[model samples]
Target chain A: MTSLTLNAIVSQMAAIEQFTNNILKILEQDARTTPAQIAVMTGRTEQEVKDQIAALEQKGIIKRYKTVIDWAKAGRERTYAFIDVKVTPSRGVGFDDVAERIYKYPEVQSVYLVSGEYDLRVVVAGTSLKEVSFFVSEKLATIDNVQATITHFVLKRYKEDFEIFEDTSEDRRLSVAP
Target chain B: MKPISHIAKTVPASGIRKFFDIVSQMDDVISLGVGEPDFVTPWRIREACIYSLEKGYTNYTSNYGLLELRKHISTYLNERWGLHYNPENQILVTVGVSEGLDLAMRAILNPGEEVLIPEPSYVSYKPCVLFAGGVPVPLGTTPESGFKVTPEQIAAAVTPRTKALLISYPSNPTGATISREELQAIVDVAREHDLFIISDEIYDRLTYEGHHTAVPELNGAYERTILLNGFSKAYAMTGWRIAYAASTPDVIEAMMKIHQYTMLCAPIMSQMAAIEAIKNCGRECDEMAEEYNRRRRLIVAGLNNIGLDCTIPGGAFYAFPSIKKTGLTSEEFSERLLFEEKVAVVPGNAFGECGEGYIRCSYATGIDQIKIALERMERFVENLGVEGRLKAAGRE
Candidate 1:
């Protein structure tokens, strides 16, 4: 009876692995792959695909779908910069409090507690280099516990999130070929 | 009217062209027809090309391609498959494997000589042989054996005028991979008959179950093998049109002569990019292959679940599901699937006669599209009635 229970547990684990692994992979590759479409791909019924996706969402595993856009190609003029900050860790919370405060601003795209000379690396985006500089000099540098800052404005984006920006090659594949 | 040559006139247009035309006119059709990756070329590789362009690399490379690119390819092949070829004389870059195949056939084949080709394979192989004034002898492989060519089939197909054995493992339509032992058997047969081997390994990097065995790596096979590989499938550099053929010096020189007169060289920008790709893009290629493997599992399971009787392919991104239960030929099934459900998969018969009862669905598209397509196909299959479903399940 114990062995039988173990077998059931093992099979249940296998089922969970199958469901989660397949759904996560599909979603990660293209989050746009809808529940209905995922159902067909994974051999699950539409309802099952929906249930698994909903469960994943409820569990906070499925986050959000993002479009990889080449802003340069779209003729959108924008400035991006990476600001490395030397921060004094708070007594009780260490870098968490400072990192959290820096990330609250709309312009601060991402903040990370990084190693090396700088403690926090904040990535900020703005309409112009001047605006980004202003944000860094005024808001970012003035934040409590921020000791110093180093700003590196991004000159050009060759790539972002696995998408190559300036590729001229057209897809030459035939619609149907052996 | 322009005067078409006799050979050109005799060669039939690709059977898929009409379907492509129809597909082009339709809207909202989810296609699993194309045999190319959905991913673009990795950014670092594209950046290398852009850097090359900025540095003014617009000029044509040598007819044999850049020495740097060749050396990298040589190192890559040696490291990956334990195959060695002199970059100076044994490798010639061509405009993708398409041109390499043509060059190899033209370089070796005499008029009316036969190249034994496994059927339901790449569409280009037979036509390339025909255009080169060589006969293509079809060696039929079946779904029963996972579409792999057997030693018996190869032995039976060999005849007096047979010049070479042309094979593409991790095959396109069927997504079958020939094992190292199986390939060794074929190599033995080739040696017995004293025939050359033309191996297209474009999909070498996409294998899931086992590592691909380059035919030239087999014992007694290296000297007589013309190995064709390209960056198109592996690196998602299809449009860059870079491929190389490695062979004995004599074959390479012969192919180079034709290549010089016809192609001149592969694009210089692409060559520079390829150098970067071979040097730096191993992790990206592995990630893409892993993604494809996941999709492969999903699509295979979905097909089998839908009662299509699909064999789980060992490599390549296609799922060659048998559609025989619909009581329709491959063409009928493909047409109905496209029109009724708005899901387009190539009729398997487009590959060859042996592909009659199946359809080739590529899992290279987004999982969402694959899922949607599967749903539509399942609905279509269910509407075929209980008898059809039973027949597909092999219980009828």
Candidate 2:
């Protein structure tokens, strides 16, 4: 009876692992996979799937759901640039303070501490190239760490967030063929 | 003044079509009925086709397909399954497995020969066999056996007229796959009976529980096997409609004969895309299979929890859940589920008669939609006294 109880516990743990792996994979591919849908796909009750998702969210495993938009295809015009920074570390904070200050800017989309010629890599987006240029010179270069900045303007985006930018091909499948 | 062929008239319209017709009339229906993958073709494969088109590869390919593409396919098959076919004469590129099946049927079948088909499979096998003038002998498999066609079953069903056995593993509707050992047993029977084997391995890459064994890989089965596979399910290239059949020289020549006049070639652009898919998109296929595996686990568990006992399907995206507890036939259950809960699932009988008391729910949709459909189905099942039946069976 004791061995049976232990085996039951082991099986229960395995089931939970299965649920976590399945839920994470679905959410990773398309966060729009609803808790209800996740339930159906996972063969768990909606409540269970929902609870697991909520737990994952609380545990920070699921940061957020995002939509991948082809801005070029959508006819939305935007300017983007990658700005590399050479920042001098503060006495105590190193690059942490400067990185935080740069990331706090609304124009800044992403910031990464790097290991190359530049100390920090910043991705910024704006309405136009002029605006992005202005942001880099006026706001980013003006930060207190106060080092040189090199900005590389993006001419074209071949792919972004796992979606190809240009996909104009029509469906070639026959309507009734198996 | 009408001239529809007798064979065309004899073949019944697919049950899937009827179910979809009803689904189309309804609004906001959460459908688990589509057989294709939810993922679009991987971008690199699509891009390869675009590249090919830009490079002026618009003309038709060789009747046997591009030698380069066939070489890559040969390499892929060899590396993945240890099965080798000479690309020059043993491979025939096709317009998806649909045309491949048709070609295989037409290539081998005499006017009155029969093809033994295991039931609860993809919808095209029976019709393709019939259209080729071969009688389709349905070999029924039961849920208790994981929907596997046992050697005993095949042995019993075989007749002198049975010239070939058509099988799809990691099956479409049932998601049932016979183990390698079990398949060897069946292959042994096929060998003893001197039957040809037409193996549809379109879903080979999608198995979750175990590796899929290509029938031709089994000893003594290669010469008699027509192994059909494609880019559709594996690479989410269904729309591309490029597939191939690998068999012995004589069988391939026979298939190519039908293919040359009828198809000329698989679309050159799609064939180019298939080359890229076969060569570069393996990781993406594995990732997609992993995603499907998760959904498979979820749907199988969800259905069984609701008293609609479902065996954990090892492959494909479908969950064949028995609706026996509700005392409703498969069609009746599908109709009511669509009408009342707005959740669309294909009736199992859409595959064959052995699927009568079951329904095939696809988990290829968004996870949220699957959950909503399951809830709606659970409610629908409870209203039909499924809970009471579960208690009576002492299964809860």
- Best model per DockQ: 1
On lDDT, the candidate that comes out on top is 1
Per-residue error (Å), model 1, residue A77: 19
DockQ for each model? 0.30, 0.20
Report the lDDT tens digits of candidate 1 across residue range B166-221.
Answer: 99988998899988999999999999999999999999999987778999999999
Candidate 2 residue B21 C-alpha distance from true site, Å:
2.0
Model 1: chain B TM-score relative to the native chain B: 0.97
Model 2 chain B: weakest 10-residue lDDT segment is B363-372
- Classified by CAPRI criteria, candidate 2 counts as incorrect
- lDDT score, candidate 1, position B282: 97
- Give the winner by TM-score: 2
Per-residue lDDT tens digits for candidate 2, residues B167-197, read 9999988998779999999999999999999
- The residue ranges of model 2 lying beyond 4 angstroms of the native Cα positions read A1-110, A113-119, A123-145, A149-178, B386-396
The TM-score of predicted model 2 comes to: 0.81
